[model samples]
Target: MSDLSKRRLKLWIRLLGVTRGAENHLRDYLRREHATTLPRFDVMAALWRRRDGVTMSELSRMLLVSNGNATAVVDRLEADGLARREAEDGDRRRIRVRLTPAGLTSFEAMATGHEAEVDAIFDRLSDNDLDTMREILTRAGKAT
Candidate 1:
């Protein structure tokens, strides 16, 4: 293999390692500190972004997860009174899920902690380093 090809392969592995490490850390943090799972946090985050609500299919698409997976999370949220599912007008088959007031308050608190945790995780990276990484990642994404 060419030198550049070998370097690219190494870079990919390094990226995956870093991503997984960070993910694991966040997962543990959420579970230990908030009594919540990462999937629940993700679902809340998506709902937080779209206050109006989103259909099950739309939510699934936005999260890049299967509808069943999204439904399971939503079910838990609804059971906890953190979210509600309402049928769209004249569309009995389409149920839109949204964060309840309690859910919004809960997510706000969680989001603050989540941001702080993420900031701390990346605290070692300088502004310039972040810029460079973003540029490189954007280019790599385009390449794919």
Candidate 2:
């Protein structure tokens, strides 16, 4: 096989394994250090980055979770007092989601801790390799 052909048929399982490893690493860190699940943190992470609170549909799209799944996650966060939902005064049907002050504090702490773990994971790469990897992955994400 030509070099390109070999890459074209490369074992997807290996790629999945690598992806799973990264997921597991983050999940483990979130569980042990933050006492939270990856899904919950992901929801908070999305909201934390938003200058203003986002609508449920926006959160669903940004997080790549189903509307139902996102709703469930939001419900859990609300129950735990980590998130608050406000109905748009003009449009009663539309709701906005934002992290509570407590939630923001929690998200910030988790972010700092998570950054360290992510940096540690990438520390093995040379600077050039890391930059290239970042560029490639960002393009890959946009393609998605």
Candidate 3:
């Protein structure tokens, strides 16, 4: 391969490594400090964004997970009284899931911790470094 191709390959590997490492750190942090799984946090975050709630299918699409996976998470959340399911109006078969009041409070607490954990992970990057990285990623996203 050409030098440019080799460099690009190395960049891809480095990007993937950084992404995975950060994710792993967040997962561990959430598990240890909050006694919650990352997936649960993610589901709650999505629901938090849409307080009106979302259908199971919509939640699955938002999370980019299988409907079954979304259902499983919702089931656990419902069991814990952190989430609730209500049949959609005029469509009993369509169930909408939303976070309970307790869920919202719980999520807010976890979110605060999550934000700190993420900030700590990227604390090494200066504002200029962040700007440069964002610019590069934006250009790459446009290309894709």
Candidate 4:
């Protein structure tokens, strides 16, 4: 095998291992807190970061989920009063989803502790290594 092929294979293994470790920690913590799954948290996080509400279609694209998947998730969030769907007067069919004030507060509380724990999970990484990892991962995401 070529040297580059071996290097790429190692990178893939490392990526999967690191991701699984972090995900498992997070999943366990969130479950203990309130039985929140990662997918639900991800949907809330996407809305949390966006100042202006995102359209349902746009959210599906951002989350790399199918439109039906996004719709089902949104339905649950709406039923829980965490999110609200607004119809545009200009286009009645277009539905934009926004987090309620309650949702914002909930996400903030959860995110604070979540960030601290996740940060410590990678505390061993040097600043330079962290930066490089973020850059590489960001590029990889764009490629996908």
Candidate 5:
């Protein structure tokens, strides 16, 4: 293989490794500190972004997950009083889900800790390093 092809393959592997490591660390932090799984946090985060609420189909699409998966998470959230589902005004078959007041409070606390944990994870990276990495990754993502 050409030098360029070899380097690209290595870069891909390194990128995957970094991504997985960061994800694993975040998972552990969330589980240990908040007793929540990544999926549950992700679902709450999505709902937190949309105050008006979202349909199950929309939520599934947003999370890039299957309907069943989204439904399962939502089920747990609802059971925990973190979320609620209401019948769509014009469509009885459709439902819109939103975070409850308790959910909002819980997610706010979680989000604050989540941000801190992420920051600590990359505390060694200087501001310039972050800027350069962000630019490189943005360009690479655009290529795909």
Candidate 6:
């Protein structure tokens, strides 16, 4: 293979490895410290961003997941009193979901800890390292 092609492949592998390792560490941290699954946390995070709430279809699209998957997670959230679903006034079939007050509080707590955990995980990287990586990733994203 050409040198350029070999370098490209190696870079891709390294990127994938880093992404997976970070995700796995986050999953373990959330589970052990918060007693929450990543998916559940994700659902709550999405809802917390929109105080007014979002339609089921909108939520599914935002999360890039299937309707069934979003519904299942929301169902669990609702059962736990972390989320509430309200039927549309004109169309009962359509429903909007929002986080409860308790959910907001819980997510705020989780977010604070999550940020700390992530910072600790990458604490070895210097400010210059982070800035350089961010610029490189931004360029790569724009290219795609």
Q: Highest TM-score among the candidates is held by which one? A: 1
Per-candidate TM vs. native?
Answer: 0.98, 0.88, 0.96, 0.87, 0.96, 0.93
What lDDT does the true structure give each of the candidates?
A: 0.96, 0.90, 0.97, 0.88, 0.96, 0.92
- What ranges in model 2 sit over 4 Å off? 1-3, 11-13, 138-144
On residues 1-144, what C-alpha lDDT tens digit does candidate 1 reach at each position? Answer: 999999999999999999999999999999999999999999999999999999999999999999999999999999999999998996888889999999999999999999999999999999999999999999999977
lDDT of 5 at 31: 98
Candidate 1 versus the native: TM-score? 0.98
Those runs of model 4 whose alpha carbons end farther than 4 Å from true positions after fitting are: 135-144
TM-score of 6: 0.93
Candidates 4 and 6 compared by TM-score, better number: 6
Q: Which ten residues in a row have the lowest lDDT in candidate 3?
A: 87-96
In each prediction, how many residue pairs overlap at the backbone (N, C-alpha, C within less than 3 A)? 0, 0, 0, 0, 0, 0
Q: Candidate 5's residue-wise lDDT over 74-136, tens digit each?
A: 999999999999998978799999999999999999999999989988999999999999999
Could you tell me how far off, in angstroms, the CA of residue 78 lies in candidate 6 after the best superposition? 0.3
Q: If the candidates were sorted by their TM-score against the true structure, best first, what order would they fall in? A: 1, 3, 5, 6, 2, 4
For model 5, the local distance difference test gives 0.96
Model 4 lDDT, residue 91, Cα: 85
Instruction: Estimate candidate 3's RMSD in Å.
Output: 0.9
70-132 per-residue lDDT for model 2 (tens digits): 999999999999899998787879999999989899899999999998888778899899789
RMSD of each: 0.7, 2.2, 0.9, 2.2, 1.0, 1.3
Instruction: Give model 5's clash tally.
Output: 0
Candidate 6 per-residue lDDT, tens place, 32-116, comes to 9999988888889899999899998999898999999999999999999999999877687888999999999999999999999
Residues 19-89 of candidate 3 have per-residue lDDT tens digits of: 99999999999999999999999999999999999999999999999999999999999999999999889
Off by over 4 Å in 5: none
Model 1 C-alpha RMSD vs. true structure (Å) is 0.7
